[model samples]
Target: MPFVDIRLAGNATREQKAAIVADVTRSLVERLGKPPAAVQVVISEVSTENYGAGGQLVADRAPVPKMGEDANAAVTSR
Candidate 1:
């Protein structure tokens, strides 16, 4: 089984999150030969105030996430 945990700086719309889950599941199925039904995706959204980068809070340094942007760019993957 493959599990993908996603963290974002702000809330994501239902459609946005569905796209991510589908994309991740497809990637795992194609790369690792995992079954779609066996893959699991988790999403966690944190307030921008709780996330910081380069010694500055993300909310102060960048705009809120929009569709087609790298909202999960700071995520940890292994």
Candidate 2:
């Protein structure tokens, strides 16, 4: 059995959560030869304020990036 623990900050949609579980199960099945039923995926959600980055806590802020923006542009360009 393969255990995968995912710690995410803030909220996510139900669809997003479901996708995560499915993807994790697939990864374990592919990488470790574990069956989908034998893979364990746990998700822990915490406040961004409790999760610090760059020595600063992420406050209640959500800057919705444009559809075309890449991840680098989304963070560094802010």
Top TM-score model: 1
- Relative to the true structure, how large is the alpha-carbon lDDT of every model? 0.86, 0.82
- Best candidate (score: lDDT): 1
TM-score of 1: 0.76
Judge candidate 2 against the unseen true structure and give its global Cα lDDT, from 0 to 1: 0.82
Error at 22, model 2, angstroms: 0.2
Clashing pairs in 2: none
TM-score of 2: 0.74
Model 2 agreement with the true structure over 1-78: per-residue lDDT tens digits: 788899887788889999999998998789889888999888988888788777767764545566887756767766
